[model samples]
Target: MRKLTDFISESFIWSVGITRPKPGQERLAALYITATLAASILAAMTMFLLVLHRL
Candidate 1:
């Protein structure tokens, strides 16, 4: 049982490549998140407008 569990755990860890972040990468990540959120908001707003127009 322990061997099986260790194998599973090791496979999971190797499957994920967790690399250290480079300098100033936090700002880049923040910008990406902001842009993604903005895009989602724009899409939602456009859909809402379309639904209202059809009514």
Candidate 2:
């Protein structure tokens, strides 16, 4: 679980062209969380539409 979390955080940082956060920078973490939630919501909507179309 720790490895997965670290991998996701690293990937998000790399995608955004940023280095690891320095101390006291919480906004980066919040940005990552929001982005992840948005992506997940989009993925779920896509899957739902696909399934509905097939039915």
Query: Residue 30 of candidate 1: its Cα lDDT?
Result: 42
- Which 10 consecutive residues of model 1 have the lowest summed lDDT? 4-13
Cα lDDT tens digits, model 1, 1-55, are 4454444434433565444236667445445544565688999999999999999
What residue runs in model 1 are displaced by over 4 Å at the alpha carbon?
Answer: 1-23
Error in Å for residue 52 of model 2 = 0.4
lDDT of 2 by residue, 1-55 (tens): 4455556677766788766677766456646655786799999999999999999
**TM-scores, all models, native as reference:** 0.56, 0.56
Clash pairs for candidate 1 = none
What 10-residue stretch in candidate 2 is worst by lDDT? Answer: 25-34
Candidate 2 ranges beyond 4 A from true positions: 1-23
Supply every candidate's count of residue pairs whose N, Cα or C atoms clash at under 3 angstroms. Answer: 0, 0
